[model samples]
Target: MTRPSPAPLRVLDLTDDLGAHAARLFVGTGADVVRLERAGTGAARSRAEELHWHAGKRVQRIADEAVLDARIAELAAGADVVLESGPTSRLRTPALREADPSVWADVVHVLVTPFGRTGPRRDWLADDVVLSAAGGMAWLGGDPGAAPEPPPRQQAEQLAGAHAAIGAWLALLARDRTGSGQLVEVSAQEAVAATLETGAIAWIHGRSVPGRTSGIYGHVAHRVFPAADGHVAGGYSGSPRMWDDLLAWMVETGEAEDLAEPQWQDGEHRWSGRPHVDEVVARFAARRSVAEIAEQGRTRALPWAEVAPPSRLVENPQLAHRDFMVEIDAPEGRLHDVGLPFESPALPRPVRLAAPADLPAGAGWAQGRAPVTTRVPRPGTPRHGGALEGVRVLDLTWVLAGPYVTKTFADHGAEIVKVESSQRKDPTRFAPGMRLRPGASYDDSGYFLNFNRGKRSLALNLRTSRGQELLRALVPHVDVVVENFSPGVLARWDLAYDQLRDLNPEVVLVSMAGVGQDGPWRSAVTFADTLAAMSGLTYETGSATRPPQGLTFGLGDMVAANAAVAAALERLHRGEGGHVDLSQLEAMAAALGPAALEAELGQTVRPRSTVMRCAGEDRWLAVGACPADELDAAVRALGAGSLADLAAASDADELAGRLQALGVPAYAVRDGHDLVEVDPQLAARGFYTPLDHPIAGPVLHEGLVEHLEATPGALRTPAPLLGQHTEELLTELLGLDPAELNTLHEEGVLQ
Candidate 1:
């Protein structure tokens, strides 16, 4: 019996490690992934790299570049999309294109490279560490006096892959309307540069350069605290109520000490009293068991979790309850892995794994569209303009993932109305990582200002029935609605998916949370750091001798944000209204790449590649994951005797150039100052846009991570002030009278 493929989309994947994550995600979305490999290539994929990412993809090996090009032309005739990575693609090379004209105007071409396709360093040698430095990520990590660090392993590559997926999906969404395919180019350096958790904002918004700390971003309120059993991540002081409850907990345990004092009681001073607060929290948490602390957190509805490693994945109660863990039998042995990132009735088979396709020799590999599962029919709407100009989004979300998701939409010309409340404001408006202005108003948060750009604020208190009624009225006017409250919060507010569907049958809605919409831990309060710790990302960081380290930024949040963005775009493209239950943890676990497999195969290393010192105080060069032969060559070229002597004598910038000249992957660990003032690649690519905010004054903001040749996205506005567009949006979208608005405000329903 032959079962037809579930998905209709056909992808010719010509990418290596650079685009592996995107291909893996496409497979999960039910696309038919056909991977092309060079016949004589020595290093196509390491065993560890190929473990889980290529489980269900089809493959063919070609002899040389000529044969590969010919095969691509032959297979690409039936393919809808082509995924290419690296700088040597023949598609863009004018010198070689004249020999073979394969100008594909019908198929979407997604190019993922270290730098952009046209940057000054586009053809320069690249590795993960090089991207981290060039992207300004390395500067934000490590201790103040130590060398900067990159996120462990191939995270830089994977981040680019995630962006590539979004770019490809967006292009295809546009194609469904315009019947044209164009270029979607993703720069890994820019992807990392854009997701620095406000790393560059201090320098961009002002002249002050922010320094690195130990894992914690800006304030020490949120971090991995040591537990009696292991480690648990919990520390959030953004909300006054959350701080009061934490203080009450400490006071109950007779451990509040100075925290109960007048000086330390104010939540605003939490940033300044970091040493004392961290000390008190550490003392309170060190003696408690992980289970005990977790129970306490649950009782208080605090965002906290155990710093779980890959080995602990199987033991996760949430995974067990959701049935997320899967077992696959291969030629080697039985292996355990995770499932899809989101669940939707809209997708018949969101995930299906089969043994690698075995086509007989001389048989064609062309399998035409089957079942049409990847995308739904295009919406029945007239096109107004290009670049998402007609889309409307109601963003009932706060903090990282939700706001970032809306930001993606808003930057691309979609109108987004972000909801907030006077009583319950977005916590990010307060202690959102690093801040550009000290003790400024709610508008000064670098994180809020950056992610909330191009969005309009609609302050409404959902607790009131009048407020809920107003929200219900606004639902019919928007194309899509997104929220990231805990599992049942929307249901309590009478705005669940079913209710939203009742309001507007064709409106697309996405409900994203930490665990999922339904699970044993669905009610678990979570933060971005909690997702990172639980997804095995934190366990693989740091040196082998030290305790495990967490990433400097919200890696998990970024992954979930892009996934949600893609889902919303897909749903809107199809013109269908459906519910999407996305687990931020599951999305992050997929980004774990081969780490889980490595842990299973006992090949896991405490990554955090070697950060070697260079000349000048604390200046360093990152030498990450070099092959044995290359490592030997680097040592010989640099005269390796004592690391201490080399640290004092070597110039990182010069040595990085020298090492790259010898085919070794090396680059300087850049700080914010270097990224803004010295990095030529960023300047040449125009990665940063200096925008003047009404309140924040002039600031350089991160632009889009990828490019769309047909219709590129732009930064339209700065972050909105609270209730900035309340009256205008209501009057414009809902036809609400000024008298009604005045009544709502007087009745305390509107903020």
Candidate 2:
């Protein structure tokens, strides 16, 4: 029997550059998105920009203001969702619902702006660069002595779009349960602020602020090493095995000099003696090609990656093997762009529809009066429980991406069983110098603590048959299973989606791999830095004159985590579970849609410029496109006759405050330390919550990114110790007897 097609969501997209990616996400997810533009409007700066954002959407131009309002009211009267991205004055949520009460009763309205709808800075004029500076990201890039660099492309705008997508999905889920729609408000500044990695948390709890580095943070050996052909991002930190492997590789190449001494054997000692280790590694790398290092290092589990550019990514072997890039025919020619971040059996493969043909010169306005008839069924109340309250997740993920996804679920009241093994612990647990205090154990690393919060630890060695049985036993009680191992690792242990389905028919399996499950490079190992390089982010992150640099740590991991949450929530709303194959490379690429579109269209992708500078050491600003008068006022407020004079001032924050008070789009560049104690806005909004840890005392945790008034999420517990709840979880969920557990422990199957 032929199955009926899935119902398409009706989405009305009224957004500019700020919300283009959000609308693109809707289109990718099979939404019937209709774009509403002004008649004769030419807002797109270039043809490439126009095609990059507007292609694959049905467009309708409205000439009269009253007619536009009526058209929106008519569309909203039947649409499932309405997305707006301009200022609040242009598209207010209250005004949209008021336009036609009955028709808009159940339509989700999403608002994306620089700030929020109600705030002191709500009406302030800003752009992507300005928002990045305000969010403290700008302050964390570039060299410590140089001006902080803003990430290339519109990252703040793209991040806001990502958050908006998550918010939209959350609202849709809520609507499905209560038969009511809501306003999913997103702030560009706040969205970027939340993804600042460990900087903000460090400042609030550890009283330490992170600064700009040449490459990865924390480790002295983690930096870009110049190779014969290009550069490779070296990530030899966290584990003694990695450090030893790097030294061995160098020794094999005859580059290890005095550094091969027994004194440098310890990972901690090697870090302290990094000058000698770096000298040897750099010499060895300079003699070899990036390909050689990447290929050889991966075989030995060394986290080394070739720094790649967007153009290079176009021909990446791993990405090509996964068919990560989709070829589309455009006016110019055939172009390639990234596809959806994940592939799920329950969701159809996303197809980019061809751009609409040009409208006739005299397109009549009367065509806008068409009646709306489509109506989505009000889904039954969610049986999965209260906003994820009773959901149970089996978290077999480690490090950043997978743990981040489970952390979100845990925050919203999901029970998360974080499975690990003492034999091969999470690298983050042993990350050097990230401990809360000196002489702290593996579980005391701040990096591990931050990501593993609200999870119960269940240490079971998956290598053992009994351990595999124990995991299979618990699968029936879990609503979801998430992991981020290299593609084939889980399947090797018979824990693949196909295997789990026999135990729990409704279980959702989310696998976050660097490439994907069925790709040629599925077995390629990856870290956050390598994923960035492969995804074309590291290529476009730095200044045009300099070699490409990476963004704040684990950018790809964070983006994939957000996408994972949306995917899980979406499946839960549908009341059906299936495999979700999420690629970290694709997730980060999705956030760079604008750049991908431009590159595919053969446009000259220019590097972002550093605009504003402030007085003080390493203080810079990213004041996008401020009005001429406001710029002038800002210069005058600094009491400087010239830019040089402004740069010589003693305090940039004080000057920024004065300019901000004068209604100028300006902000002082802030490092993690600066934001912890100084960001009044984040404090006012309660973006930090204190959680009591048994050993660390009261530690502050980051707050939720999205706000759902009816069911806001919370951080309920601290991070668990290694195997802290193994006995409890085994007894309660798997009904394992004490004798069996003791036997398992004696057999080394359970830690």
Encode model 2's per-residue lDDT on 393-489: one tens digit a residue.
9999887788889988877657889999887767667554556445667876677777888889999988898998888888888888998877777
lDDT of 1 by residue, 1-751 (tens): 1123234578878776677778877776667788777765425454555657777777777667776777676666566677887654333223322454454655677888878877666666677777787677777776778777677667788888888888887787667656667778888888988777656766665457667767775543688888898888888655567688888988998998888888777666866878778888998889899788887887787877777787778688887676665554566687666655665343343344654554333344456643222332224322334357667788998878888899998877678888898677676785444455666578767768888898889989898989888898988888789998878888887889899988888788888888888767777778777778877777766555667657667767878988888777656655566777778998787677766667777774544456787888778887656667777766677797644466458888877776767766667777777777777778898888877788878777888886888867888788988889999888887888989999989999878
Model 2 compared with the native: what TM-score? 0.89
Provide the lowest-lDDT 10-residue window in model 1: 371-380
Model 1, TM vs. native: 0.90
**Best candidate per lDDT, number?**
1
Query: Pairs clashing in candidate 1?
Result: none
Collision count for each candidate, in order:
0, 0
lDDT (Cα atoms) of all candidates against the true structure: 0.73, 0.71
Off by over 4 Å in 1: 1-7, 40-46, 89-103, 247-264, 268-271, 344-352, 358-366, 369-386, 430-435, 605-609, 624-650
The estimated TM-scores of all candidates read 0.90, 0.89
Lowest lDDT sum, 10 consecutive residues, model 2, at 372-381
